[model samples]
Target: MEFSLLGPVGVATGAGELVLGPAKRRSVLALLLLQPNITVTIEQFMSSLWEDEPPAHARTVVQGHVSRLRQMLAEGGAEAYGVELVTRGSSYLLRLPEELIDAHRFSGLMALARPESAPQDAVSLLREALGLWRGPALSGTVSGAQFAAAAHALEERRLAAVGALATAHGALGEHDHAAAILYAEAAANPLREGLVAALMQALYRGGRQSDAINWFHRTRQLLGEELGVDPGERLTRAYEEILRAEAVATQPPARTQPPARQQPSGPVDPRVQPAPERAQQPSIPRQQGHAPAAQGRSPGSGTTGGPGGTDSTVDTGSTGGTRGTGSTGGAPDRSTAPRFLPRPPARFLGRETQLAELTRWLTDTGSGESPIAVVTGPAGVGKTACAVQWSHRYASAFPDGQLFADLGGFGEGAEATPTAVLREFLLGLGTPPEQIPPSADAASALYRSLVARRRVLVVLDNARSSAQVRPLLPGGPGCATIVTSRSRLDGLVVTDVARPVPVQVLGTDEGVALLGTMLGHDRVAEEPDAARALVALCEGLPLALRAAAAQLTARPRWRLARLAAALGDERRRLSLLSAEDTGIAAALRNSVARLSADDARLLSQLAMGTGREVDALAMAALAGSDPERARDGLDRLAEMHLVDEAATDRYVISTLVQLFARDKEAGEGGSPPASTER
Candidate 1:
């Protein structure tokens, strides 16, 4: 049987086509095929399927799905040859090779469509590679965490295909054709600088000099207007060449074009943030008219920039370093503020100790290499506040502007696409929109180029996964990132360098102090017992404390004691603490609601289990898995901030979460008896 999953999940045989029934079963099959000949493990598979939330009996359900898939495969002729997709220890793996999948074919064609390939061959290969895309990847699957991630991966590949095709056309010397094709691609995906740059370079080669220059201007405008960023270096270099070539012909450049600027020999700007390790050169700009009909040449390198900003240089080559008008034509200065960015809110009381620890970490950057610290905790645990406060305090340390992006690990809506975020970032640094690359890889390169030598602080808030954060991380040693999320970024943290700092609830004293700040010493002191009870009920969570205090302050008739009485009832407590929105209960729910059914069930079981803290071993026993697998489940719980790791190898749920989880378990007829082991 020829198994396929690179694009579209399918099973093939010489006889005919094999049907992979149902979307979820197909998804499980696709995932299995993607990792052919390897076990996917139950834990990893579930994580892929549900992300954070899974239904009760998700495991049994997955098993049923997998069994159905295997049965389908068998009916489709796999049984004839004694070939079958089967479940192994913890995971399922398909028996297949690289040649069977369309994904592999696409990758193979991509490799053949290199710059050196003949025009005809390159075009053919590009077409072949593109042919593999059969609508959005896993089109049949339901919208969930696994599908979301798979879709993102597929989209990345699609963009890569566009870039490859454009490059092949450039090599084939069809500059105009390449430019036109890339133009449409860029328009559709403005965040991809590679596509944008390709179009610009093609235009320049095709002798559309004026058009190239205009493209640079338009790119700058779009980037600034939309994302507050600048054009990338590749686009900058391509436009720079157009200007220089025009100068040599003794032809006056368009009024919009700046005079041929001379290249500066030193570093660009001291305040510019550097790029991450993998970004390519800048994007290409778009011109209104004029399609040059010249042959394509190797992409030039040199000092390229957006609007008035000078792109950083580390001695790369470009089409004749004409140093033309030190900046992209008609571009804005890089020093402008983003149009829609709101001023940060002020910090409140409590978190003195946590703040100090953060400061220490900031200062500890002196230890060999700075750590990419993750501030993770329950929602409303003040993770964002702590990160923001620390960033504000240490603003002087990172002279570059503070970069912020919310990855939306827990919320809905487009969780700031990495490319979109990069575009915004580059525009802010001064890249023109037209010049931006139409590919994530190219944008990442440009970002790294821009920040290769600067000291910058990047704060990634609400990151959904390591993939989202990977592109946004700045490249230089001088750069440090602080990521805040309710979910623990296990993938990033496990990579040896990045470490996680799990933010716990405020200590008892700190919680009381925060309440004091809001209710006043006189009021809090007058109801000391009530205040203590209130803090206890809140589980010493900073956000819960603040919300409780806000509630009391809002109602003059309600005394602290009365509020405490309302909160003492577990079920009514969360309901009582809840406001229309923006309260402890709401925050916790936001995190919890994002969970997959499996995680929710595990959490409920945890609440039904023993002690203030449970180790991975205990959870594994309760969840009926090994410690390693159990840890992954626990990490998911911890990310929702439903469970806190109070001690190394131990975990605890917030007081309210504990009560709620237990109540939920009982409501669901409770979990199997809590494991006393470990």
Candidate 2:
């Protein structure tokens, strides 16, 4: 019997939703559902139920609640439901298959709704699984620790469901549908620009090009009014593209001209208009309307005119034209969308060509090519921010919405397994936990199918390898994806794998501009010699520059001259580059801390290796291990961004990074640097 804890408490057997007891009893059942297959002692239950205190007969009262829950489960007449809520020495144990609990079920289905599945199947499965929610998981209960955990799990599932649906619509080339979903969600959750951007993409692709153009304006207005800032550079660029009418060609209405279908029983609101053609005057020249043959759809599914064709205003949650109550036109109205994680900060300095190239690839300059781009860089060269900013810029192209996840290429713990990343991606898409499939492969299939033709942007940041990103690719064409990694994901058989853009440190001009932005341009210009010295010390690394800027921001009295002097000493440079959560030193340490013991040792040894390019054989010799061990260490270091893989079997470290590592070694009072054939 399958169970679902994703919605208002209900246990589904083959029969139907088994009614639990009263609110108290339902609460108890919900708690049990959260920890299925685990024993919850009476004391723990009571404390969770009533944190401060409980009645003298709390134990008996708990028993009564349990009894009621049992009867409710049995009411559905399913043997599995009636089977057991057993007594294990002084505690009650709930035993059921992982699939029988709603929360668990949601997780399973989310896994199933990945990028690789057939589009129709993934959409149907994701929507069905997400529909289980009546409201928040165990709504109406004052959450304690157990409820909190369950709620987080359920919310994650919800996001996964949305992500799956958004992706599916994109894959199927249904940008209008995707935009509607994304707009609704973004309005509900304004803090999540990723969703807003996704909706913007859908709008652009759905022929609602005007709506997409206006969205960034609304976003900027919202961010300024609510968040006290301008829309970031990425969002700004997307807006500029729409205004300029240079957006990619939208998925056409249909090919083969399917028979018109009966309309649903709703009046066409007068406010909506047919989506406009892309490229207004002065933009790129317009092209003749050409429709790609539809895939996967059976011959009979009818093509009705979209709402854009109707005069009715499409009320998919977001307000248009007139400013409604809580509208983005006035303030930063939160869209009714699930929040994906925020993009990495723009600590990155330069590389405009890389950004333009990425944008060009995604939009393809009216060329009818599939959209996929990969970003490659040496360690600490700022690939993640490039991907993040690029997504921010072309967000409108994918209007169904945006999805982002770190593949944990160099993060703490295990390199993020594809399955784990897919699980998170599904949640971001809005899959309920109970709906995620059982296996990673199944989840990957589902993920691909979901994004077959939607204009959603999936940013797989900090990936380790192609295997890490392969299962994550959406099957159909409408969706676009950007992956950032140290390794070159060449030779991977996927469509539109653009040439890897090698992210290097900022050039002198870009580095200086970056510093000017952080520290005052006036101050830096006043001391040109000192400014050049500071940039040199930072080695034009964006992270290091930001860290330096942050430090200077904190200490107004310290001059750039003093700061330059501190950086001149290798012993103090690492300290100068340290910031709490964001800094060159801290980021590197995080990468180091996450490594396996073997990997960590290898990194430390490799750090001391000197060369413009450190090869595997020399690295292996330094590690006192064989070629394989050395290669593994090199790979680990590359993933961590401490050392970069420059080319086949050649590794290099940034000037700042090498100095930082050297400083760290000196602080530890190491004898000498590891030897290398110069």
Candidate 3:
């Protein structure tokens, strides 16, 4: 069986090419086959299929396509070649030999066709590699940005192969063949500096120095007009080498470029929150308890924001699940002062200390500056619930309107830009839509001007970065802003003096009590030991405990031990979390998804280890890089809440997060960075 992404995405088995049906079905297959034996989440499919907002039921559509593809692959006897597509949790995995993928095969051939290889052998490998392309990859098939980026990355490698091939031809003393190859490729892609450099060298080697020089001048003129720059180093280096009449080597001389960012395909990883080791820490808190939502002023009808704020369009949905008595996304009515504090959490857990701290700091009145409080934690860690719960408790202090914006920093959806958020806040403050300025700076200035003396409460939830929350900070005395985010938003702390309250998973006792509250006291009484076991399984995360409770409540026949037993295995824990709709797995994915390609790769490597705590040395061993890189990666992972710093150099992975990481590693198909690293 062969899966091809080199040209049109296709599957060819011993039965011959199988019909992939629609373009999207092929796209689904193409994306899955992009990394064979790896799981592609439905969210990733939606991301690859549509660049903008996907239609409702996009998940169902993707499932239908996957179902049909499965039937076709089964009927085509793909299993005969050890290939099969299967679903795991919220993701799909395709198991097959990597050699069966044309893209993978192409890469392998390129690696072997190095410029350092013997010219004859290199030529053979290059021709075979180049021959695999029937046309441009994913030809005639439209896809979203991720696919486009992947295709662009693939095309780059193909060109690199072409350059290596041309150099081989030159080594074989077939300058005309080399020049011909470079000429045709360069003609089509006149802007690629590498291709131009190779073409120039090929012409020079063929005793056509004047021809090469002329080509350089032409390219130089084209670059100046089109790109507003002269030739880059590669083109210039080849030109100078030709001018000096010096002999050149098989490979072109140019500065090595950095690798491109790797595109991670899955649910975004959760934002990481730091915590002391369980024993070292005295307490940790989770959020619960839904308070009455403070109402917004009457909304003005038919108001929409300016173009610059489109992505930041405000949804008037109460963050606390309370419905505001108004239409969504309208200007606030000036008749009554609005109370905008989001309703507090519905299921309040522990976090008394943090709440009191917020109350003391922000309510001081004599602090001289508006107090900004940030509640930081990983996704599913209940940061938002804690922040809002506290906000509702102190609602009487800020009689002015309360403002809330869910800056989608850590989730599958687009991260909210500051400009978009400002528009919504401005409108919420009763500024007419037409009066709203188009630029972020202008809008921010107007908003600050209008809010100068108001004692408003601003709750910015799910913020991606500190920069996103800065402009939304209102000015005035008696005003306070509370932000909930995965990152610590250190910049806000440093520059804006935002107070940070880090939310960790609930402590053991609080987690068990919360679980009992969800499942009922009788259930806990009946399975006393089992209840404790379940809490340990949940690892003090309220979201996980709530999910486990909900799962048990829905199926009363299932004992707590049964659920506990199910979650005992690390590998299946995340899958179980998904099954229970616990949100931990998705949160983990969201956090992981935020990492840079290199950092994500390092995470997968680190997850391949055996022990729970891995210091920089162990991480370095797994990273197969320097200690500095491993330390940096560990710190980065910890900041994202993917890993936790247990000590100065030691990092720890939660049971659920570790499972998700292993799943990602398995999907990408690699062994642990090293078996001995841990």
Best by TM-score: 3
Model 2, span 1-678: residue lDDT tens: 555565577666666666564666777776677777888888987987876778899889889888776666566654545457777776887776666665666666777776445777787777666655655677755567767776886686687678678888888998766775565466556656666677777776776554564455445555655888766655655544553454234222222333232221322222222222222222221111100000000112101111121111111111222111211112212242222324334344567899888876777636544566788765566887788777776766766556666665654324556666665454333333344565778777655544444456777777766776778777546666788876666644354455576787777777778889887899778877887888888887777777777666534556889888888887778767864334577566545555566665565566676654688988777777899878877876675556778898899876666765666566668643333211
Order of quality (TM-score): 3, 1, 2
Q: Candidate 1 regions off by >4 Å?
A: 1-347, 363-371, 494-496, 608-632, 645-651, 659-678
Task: Give residue 98's error in model 1 in angstroms.
Answer: 85
Cα RMSDs of all predictions? 22.8, 23.6, 27.0
lDDT of 1 by residue, 462-514 (tens): 77677878888877667778888777777787872676777766767777778
What are the lDDT scores of the predictions, listed in order? 0.63, 0.60, 0.69
Worst 10 residues of 1 by lDDT: 293-302
Model 3 regions more than 4 Å off: 1-335, 580-582, 670-678
C-alpha TM-score for every candidate: 0.48, 0.46, 0.52
Selected candidate, larger lDDT, 1 vs 3: 3
Q: Candidate 2 local accuracy as lDDT? A: 0.60
Q: Model 3 residue 134 lDDT? A: 62
